[model samples]
Target: MGPKGPKVIHVGYTPAHVEQVFFPHAEVVGDLGLSLARLARAG
Candidate 1:
């Protein structure tokens, strides 16, 4: 992996503290099913 990599999408129950420390710029989606559906459609 280089500077540019696949987009990181974090779904469900991600607290702000954890998110800030770990998933900085990740796309945080609350609904797991909805997010999966969207990803499937996009693919």
Candidate 2:
């Protein structure tokens, strides 16, 4: 990938929505959870 190319990244958040508000990217492919008590589920 080039400097301007799109990249895939992995983010693990016990409270999912926390970082989501700061992430400007519309494409999110990862677990969804409000808390760590629940299991890790993909989006």
Candidate 3:
């Protein structure tokens, strides 16, 4: 074991995509959600 570098967290992208997005220097995190949602209130 040795010193570590920056910590990364992926939202919803594949490993390959994540690597590309982070320039192949980031730790990949699992998907967060499947679908997005929006809420509205009546006045």
- lDDT, model 1, position 16: 39
Against the hidden reference, what TM-scores do the models get? 0.43, 0.19, 0.23
lDDT of 3 by residue, 1-43 (tens): 1125455533344554633335444433454343222111211
Residue ranges of candidate 1 with Cα displaced over 4 Å: 1-7, 13-16, 19-21
Q: Which residue pairs clash in candidate 1?
A: none
Error of 1 at 29 (Å): 1.9
What does candidate 1's lDDT look like per residue over 1-43, in tens digits? Answer: 2236544555665533443335434655567788778779988
lDDT of 2 by residue, 1-43 (tens): 3445565343453323525334323333345354323433432
TM-score of 2: 0.19
Q: Per-residue error at 27 for model 1, in Å? A: 1.6
Evaluate all candidate structures by whole-model CA lDDT and list the values in order: 0.57, 0.39, 0.39
At residue 18, give the lDDT of candidate 2: 29
